[model samples]
Target: MLIKGYDDGPLVAGESLLPRPGFWSNYLMAICGNEPGASYVPEWFGDDGADADDLSEVLFDPERWPVFRAPAQGGPGVVVIYRNLLGDYGIDYLLTHPGRSHAQHVASWEGDLSGTGLSWDELIRIADTPATGEGVKDSAARLLLVLPLLTDPDLPDTAPARLTAALSEAGAPQDTASTTAEHLLAQLTRRSQHDPTWESPLSGA
Candidate 1:
């Protein structure tokens, strides 16, 4: 797909994984310590021969999405969502291998920033070369973690305002929250000088 706003950008060759609109929203909800809507409530499951009942355990019933996990380098693995069928989803807990696509152990993370023009490799290069943030990797990751929700058109509030509330909820002082939210939005604005696109923030940053 042209990926909407990226119409003037590169024509990438990968298809989007994770149920869009729902995926990142789910991730954002999880990070915000909220329930990820009944949508994530499994209608059925396929992981580890799990039945619908067992899915409660798979998703961490009591803790809920708050416990949604990801692995670190050389550490224990975590469950990742995947397509079970056209409209179905399942999770795979890689118990044996440490995650590597985004580098489980190191601070290194690589993934498409969707509408954003910046390549993760480019971000790393800038960071490593210095003089700039090369921008903070974790800062970028924080944006990515919530960009979908922040940018969501269906949201009742504007992106910047929504992010500010989110930051405040996460413990940033109101002033800090407002400034950081504006900074994040500014980062996206400055990043796409040509046409438009954007964040790669990590969870709970």
Candidate 2:
């Protein structure tokens, strides 16, 4: 019989063995500092028999999202772009309390961002730009950077230009101007219905 966590069969008539967890076994791998190819299960999952309960805790835990601190003076932040149980890509974020270890959810693709002082359009703009020496600012930025690349490949070249313009027009006021030009390469490829003439950031393009 097949079980959720057991992929391998019994070793002997009375002896049983647990299947090793795969690279994609759980969401914690996305940020838990564990390398992807490791065969062992994460300690967070508990013993082999507790797999079900461990999974439940991972899915329901309020602090499940991984946190990344800013390099300079900014507070801690988290940017997670993960596939949900439904196999759809989703994004989430958290802002840490000043001088404290705790943080709170500030944004998600499916929820409100009113508390973040950022808008979806501004996020899309930032995602389009190439990473600076500072790197990506947050999880929302990372999601916007990747989502369009995975979109339908048949979109027209003009689509990205138009989308960029629209997003820019919709963007909120900022303290300073962005140095990079808006990214519309994915849109351009999709709209043109062809592969990029230049190299792509995605692997195996």
Candidate 3:
């Protein structure tokens, strides 16, 4: 007897069950491809020449950019850092899932530099801590380190401002933490264009 599978794997005599792929499995495969390549750019990272409106669509669309989870070993959740034209920063601890309709947001710090009151050394210290050790503190610290890099000096002064405003209007703060994360993620994605260092967080590094 012959058995058929979705992607065509080895055939076995006994009954074999093939579990359906999860939402992320298919989504990631389509965007990133079955094998890694230079062409793969995550949905979180807006396309080249994309404007604030384009970024807003990339960030706020849950179907496109779902919430990420930590490893089963227990580590820090995903952290996103964003900076506006006024030099304000936002740090968030994201608890979101692809299965959920909304994301949960826990703001560690939002608005203004003084709000966080963290020095560079302090911030680094926090980031250096293992994610599995100090979950919240580690995420916050990583965001702090990433915040400054999010701003691209060469970009127009209005870019960050426009993106921030657009994100706010897209129900970022009022909607869910996941939505707010998308806003910050948009900025990080933009920064990655100029600086490769900004790509680390997205890769779960």
Candidate 4:
């Protein structure tokens, strides 16, 4: 039950609550901002609860793809595509087909990306450790957030290189290894924002 918002990542999750109207409004604003003269068209929603099949249909269909491809506004430039199903296909579909005539990337908090190859639970535990505190926690959380998006198998094994690269590019403070840990934790706690390219940045830092 993840409802990612354009204004902020993971607007809501782990609940059956409907997404706030303001969130949708923000998304609409972002779309219009990107395409100045684009007209608003009412989309056909499912009568029954939305399932993966319906969700997949929306993503795969050429007409509907534009809605999800809109660039994120008011935060990171990336678009926020909510996948209620949290399935592999949702992620794979975006990576496979990102629509056309746009240079924006869809950055999402996916999988687990803390430690060399730790599980989500393990990553959380590490982040929650008293010694880790906010800085390290935020770093660890962000890495975990990006874990699911990477196409790497044995994600735990190869994530460090990617994390280090992102940290360096973002000008993350301290040594590469420590900053990577901090970035991952920051993501889980919603203390940071990962750029469209997946570089986690500490907000207000």
TM-score for each of the candidates? 0.27, 0.25, 0.24, 0.23
Model 4 C-alpha lDDT per residue in residues 15-62, reported as the tens digit of each score: 111121122222222222223344332121111223323433443343
RMSD of 3: 19.0
| lDDT of all predictions | 0.31, 0.31, 0.30, 0.30
Give every collision pair in model 2. 79-139, 154-190, 155-190, 155-191, 156-191, 156-192
Off by over 4 Å in 4: 1-78, 81-153, 156-158, 176-205
Residues 57-152 of candidate 2 have per-residue lDDT tens digits of 444333332222222133232333221324433444443333554444544443211123232333343344433233343433343233322323
In model 4, how large is the Cα lDDT of residue 38? 41
Candidate 3: segments with Cα more than 4 A from true spot: 1-47, 51-55, 62-114, 133-205
lDDT of 3 at 28: 21
Please provide, for model 1 over 57-129, each residue's C-alpha lDDT reduced to its tens digit, 9 standing for 90 to 100: 3233222222122222333222222212223232222211333343122111122123222233323222233
lDDT of 3 by residue, 51-126 (tens): 4334444333423222222211232233332212134223333332334444334333332111112222322333
Model 2 spans > 4 angstroms off: 1-78, 81-83, 87-89, 110-180, 184-205
Model 1 weakest 10-residue run by lDDT? 103-112
Give me the overall lDDT of model 1: 0.31
